[model samples]
Target chain A: MFKKILFICLLPLVASAQETIYDSFVLAPGWTKLSFIPPESGTYTLPTYPKATNGNVINHKSEVKSLYQLYDNKITLLNFMYTTCTDINGCPLATAVFHKIQQKVSKDPVLSKKIRLLSLSFDPKNDTPDVLKLYATGTDKQLVDWQFLTSSSPELLDPILRGYQQRIVKEYDENGNYIGSISHILRVFLIDQEKNVRNIYSVSFLHPDLLINDIKTLLDPKTKNGTVIARSAN
Target chain B: MKKLISTLYGMLMSAFLAVALVPTQAFSDETCMSPYMAKIVGQEDYVYVWTLGQVGVGDEQDKLVTIAVNPNSPHYGNVIGHVSVGGRNEAHHSGFTDDRHYLWAATLDTSKIFIFDVHTNPNKPKLHKVITNFVKASGGIVGPHTTYALPGRMMISGLSNNQDFGGRTALVEYTNDGTYVATYHMPHDENLYGATKTGQIADGYGYDVRALPRRNVMITSSFTGWNNYMMNLGKLMGDSDAMKRFGNTVVVWDLHSRKPKKVFDVPGAPLEIRCAWGSQNNYCFTTTALTSQIWLIYEKDGEWQTESVGTIGDPAKIPLPVDISITADDKHLWVNTWNDGMTRVFDISDPHNAKEVYTKVIGDQVNMLSQSWDGKRVYFTSSLLANWDKADGPEKMPQFFKAYDYKDGELQFKFAIDFATEKLGMPHQMRFGAYSLYAKSPKDGAKVAELSK
Candidate 1:
C-alpha cells in the first residue's frame, strides 16, 4: 500500500513533461546493464580527488542542518539534483542509482550503519522543503540513511554548488522568461568520512554496483590509514 | 520576423537539449575533447590557441591567443585577445576541465601548466592558476604532454622524466584546482606494471592519453622524451641513437583503478589517440610518426587487440603523422602529417580498413587539427616544436592558423592568420570557447562593430 501511494505521488512529477523528455533519448547505462565489470572492493584504491565542501541545507522535514552534520563521519554519496528534472540521463539516473544503493544497503546491516546518501537539489526555488518532503516519502523505511535536501534560496545554495563545481544553466523561454528547468551535467560525489571526495561519477560511471564497491573499498580496514597499496611494479 | 523568431526558438531548444541530455562520448565541440567536459553544441565564439614563443617574436613569451571564430560575430576571423605567460615553455597542448570553465595548457620544456578561466570572459581569457610544482609533485614526471579531463580531475600524460629526460614516464592525476592526486608509471620491459605484454615490445614511453568510459578503458600512446623532442629536428633525425628513442608501444589501462592492463607494440611513435564517438563502436585509431601507418585498437572476443589497419601517405617519406581528429559520426578521420604539410581525410566507416579518401595542403607545415561538432569547419595550426619547427630561413618559418569550411566533399578556404607575419608566436593547440557555456551573450554595441569592421 505504501509503495503504491508513493509511486502515485511521484507519477505526476515524471509523467507529462518529463516523460516526453525522457522518451526522446535512450536511458543511461546506470539504468541499463553496466557494460564492464567493476573492480572488486578493497582490491583497488580510490584516491582523494578534492575536499567536499559544507553548506547549510534544509532537510525534507524543514529542519536546518549543516551538510557536514548529515555526513557525521559516514561514507557519503553526495548527488546534486532537482525534484522535477526531466532528463532521463541526468537527475533521474542519479536518483535511480541511489535508490538501488539504498536497496542493497537495506539488506546488509553493516553497510546500512555506515552509508549515507544525499540528494541535494540545485533548484531550490522549485524544490522547497515541503515539496522534497513529499518527494522523499517512504525513504525513511530504508535501512541506509537517505536525505533529500534543498536550500531556502539561491544565496544559500550557490556556495555548495560552486564548491562542488556543479555547473548549471537555467533554461529560458522564447520571450526570455524563466522556464523552471535547469540543465546540468549529472555528477555524483563519493566522499569519505574525512570529507575528502574519493571519486566522482558521471552518467557513464554511475552505477549501483560500482558505488557499492567504492563504498566497501572505503570501509575496508586496510584503507583506514588512508594509504593506497602501491601497485605492483613487476 | 516570425520566421526569425521560430528559427531562434528552434536553435535555443536544440542547444538546451544538447547541453542538458547528451551523455559522455556522445557529442563534442572539437570532436577530440575529453568526454567528461561539457561541449559547445552550437557556434563557438573563440578558439584559444596555446602558442610557443619564438626567440625574436613580438613578446618572446608563450601566450594563450584567442581568435574570434563565430561567423555571426562582428569580430569573426580576427585575433581579438592574447595573454602571454612570461617566457617560452614549449606550449604544446591544452584541454578544458570537466565543467568546461577552465583550460589547462602545458609546456613540455618547463613542465609548467597554465590554467585559463575561459568562462569568465570567453573573448579575453584570463590566467586562473599556474601549476609550477608539476615535476616535484608528480615525483619527477616531466614534460606534461596531454592534460586530459577525468570526472573532476585532470590526467596529464608525461613525455619525459627528470631523471634521464628519456621516453620512460608516468601519467599524473591532479584535481581540477591543481592539486596532485597520484601517479601511475607506464609499464616497460623490466616492469610490466601488472600489464601483460601482448607483443614483444613493452616500451613505457608516454605521449597522449584518452579514455573510453563506457568500456572502462583508458589508452595512452607513446612518443619520444625531452632529450629528442627538444633537440634540433634536423640533427635528431640524422642521429640514429636519438631516433631510436622514439616510442614503440601503446598501453591499454583499466580506467577505474588507473592500472595498465595490456601493452601493444605499435612501433614508430604513435602521437595521437582518437577513439570513435559511437557508443558501440568500441575502437580507437592512432598513426605512427616514423612508420606512417594507421593502427586500430579494438576489443575482440573480450580481449583488447591491436592491428595495423592502413598506411598514411607513404611510410618511406616519413610524413610524420602528428595529430588526428575523428568526426562525431565516427565515419571520417582527419589526420595531420606535420612534415608534408598535408591534412588527409580517411574513410573510417570500415574501422578495420581506413582508406585515404581526400587530401588538402593546409600550409607549409601543419601540426594540429580541430574540427567542429558537425565536421563542417576545420581548424589547423602549423607549429610542431620550437626546435623541430621547419624554417626556410632564420625567423621565416611559415607558422599559421588556418580555418577551412568542409562542405560537399571539399575544403573551401575561409581565412588564415599567419602567426609569424603578425608578430605572434607559433600556435600549437586550439581549444574552442563560447559565451553560451556560461549563459552569457556576446557584448552588444560599437566596440564589436568596430572590431568587426
Candidate 2:
C-alpha cells in the first residue's frame, strides 16, 4: 500500500519527465529556415455558396439587421445555439469551439480583420439579445468580430432555419411532460465574403488549424497545390 | 380600358421577376473554401499515430506514437516517442481540438477517453487525463468510435447504447475536460422495424459522422457497434438474423438545430465519409465494406441523393473496403480494402462520376490510411477491430505501418514497420501532429491556460 501510494504520487512527475527525441523536421537541406508569408491582404474572394437567406436578427447591442448585413464583405463562422444550453456538445460545444477560434483570430490582425463570427439562438423566446450579449461578452475579447445574434421570435427564425436547412426538435419525457429544452446536432458554417457557405464544420474538422488554414486559403487562393506557402511580410 | 392595361403590365412584370430569380441558382457558382495550405517550416511536420495493443501482447496497452513524416527531415519515418496507457483498452480513433493542442483518443470496448497533450511536445504526447467512467457519464452509451473536436468540445459517435447490443446508438458530446454534456440518439423509424425485409436498408447503428456547416448539414454512416463488432465475422455473416444486424443507413442532419433531415439508405457497412476538399465540390464519398462499393452523397435539384458510382473489389469475394481518404486537391480518393490489403486510388474530379485510376496492394491487411496536409505522403496501418480481424493463416498478416509517396500517378513504397515481428501489438487510427502556428488570443490568458492545461 505504501509503495502504491508513492508510485501514484510520482506518476505525474514521471510522466512529465518522459523524453521525446524530436529532431525538428528540416523544411530544407541546409537546416536554415526561411520566414513564411505572414497573413497578408490579397484579392482572394471566398468561393460563393447559395445566397444566405435573408433573416431579421437583433445583435447583442439590441440593433436589428438582416443576417446578410453581418457578413459585411468578410468571412463568417455562423452557428445556431442558445445561451442557456448546457449540453457540452450542443450550444456549449459550439460556443466553446467558436470562442477558441475567435481567440486564435484575435492574435492575427489579418484574420481578425477579414473574419467574423456570429452565434444565433434558435430559442429566441429565452435567449434575448441581452442574454446573448452576456454570453458573448468575454467571448470576443480580442474584438475579433465575434457577435451573438438572435431573431425576435421563433416564428421569424423559422424561415432562416428552413433556408439553411437547420432543424430543431423539442424533447419530452415518457410522462408526456414538456422538457423545456431541445435536442440537435451541433453544426458550424463557414461563410465567405459573398455570403456563400464555403464549408460546414460539425464535431469533426472544427479545429483551429483546419479553420485558420481554410480562412488563409480563402484569403490567398494562390497557395493551392498542397504546399504550405507561409510568407512573413516583416 | 386604362385600368385593364395597367393590370396586364403588372402581371407581366411579376412573371419576369420570377424567371430572373430562377437563373440566380445556376449562377451561384460552386462556392467553397479552399483548404488552408500551411507551408511546412522548421518544427512543423510530425504524424501522430494512435496505436492499439492486443490483449496479452507485448506491453498490452494502447499508445500514442509520434513519427517525423517530413521528407526533408533526417528523422523522417522514425518513431520519435510514444506514451503507453497500460491496458489493451481498444484505443481506436483520435482527433485534435480546434486549437490543435489537446487530442482526445477513445477506447471502444472499455468506454474510456484519454486526452493527450499533443501541443506540449508534438512528438512526445503525455497522457493529460483519463475519463474512465464514460459509460455512466454518457448514460450507458458504449463502443465510442470516433472522437471529433469542435471549437471547444469533442463530439463522439458511439456504436451501441446500454439498453442492449442492438442497433440503437447515440452521439455523445463532452467538454474538452471530458465532462459529460448530453447524448443525441440517432432517429429510429419504429414503423419500419419489422417492415425491413432482408437486403433492405434501415437506420440505427452510428459509425463515422462528418459535418457540412455551410449547408447546415451533418451526416453519420452506420457500422456495427460493440456487441456486433466482437462477434465472429464469419459466423455472423452466415446467420441470416446476424446479417440483418449490420447498419444500412446514412443520416443527414441540420447543423444548427441538430435535427435529422433525411436518412438515406447506404447498405453494407459504410465505414468512412470524405467530403470533397475543393471549395466548389458539393458531394462527399463513402464506401460500403460488405458490398465493396463506392457511394456518392450530394445535393441534386435541391434534394440530397446517394448513388453507387463504382466498386473496388469483387463483392462476391468480400474484399471489404474499410477506409476512404480524399486528396487535398479533391482530385483523387484513396480507398483501402481490408480483406486483400489493397489501396485503390480513384479520380474524383467529377465527384458524381469517379473512376479508379490506380491500385496498389500494400500488405496482407490494411485498415486505416492517413495522408499529409499536402497530400504527398500516405501512411497505412493494419488492424480493423480486434475480434473481427481475418483468421490466422498465410493471408492472416501481422499488423504493420507503411509509408508511400504518390508522385506522377505512381505509389512508391518508402518504408514499412512490422508490429508482429517487433511485438509492438496492433496499430490503428493515425493523425498528424503540428505546433500551434496561430498566436494566443484569450481574454484572460491565465484562465485560458489553466483550462487548456
Which parts of model 1 are misplaced by more than 4 Å? A1-4, A7-26, A225-234, B1-29, B393-395, B445-453
User: Per-residue lDDT tens digits of candidate 1, residues B1-453?
Assistant: 436533543454344445444453434347677763556655667889999999888888999999988888788899997999999999999998877889999999999999999878888899999999999999999999899988778999999999999999999999888999999999998988789999889988999999998888999999999999999999998999998999999999999988899999999998899998777789999999999999999998778999998999988988889889998878888899988899999999999999999998987779998987766788999999999888565367898999988898799999999898777899999998877676666774212110100
TM-score of each: 0.92, 0.60
RMSD in Å for all candidates: 6.9, 20.9
Residue pair clashes in candidate 1: none
For model 1, residues A85-135, the per-residue Cα lDDT tens digits are 776667877877887798788899987998999999998888888888765
Evaluating just chain A, the predictions reach TM-scores of 0.90, 0.72
- Return the top candidate by lDDT: 1
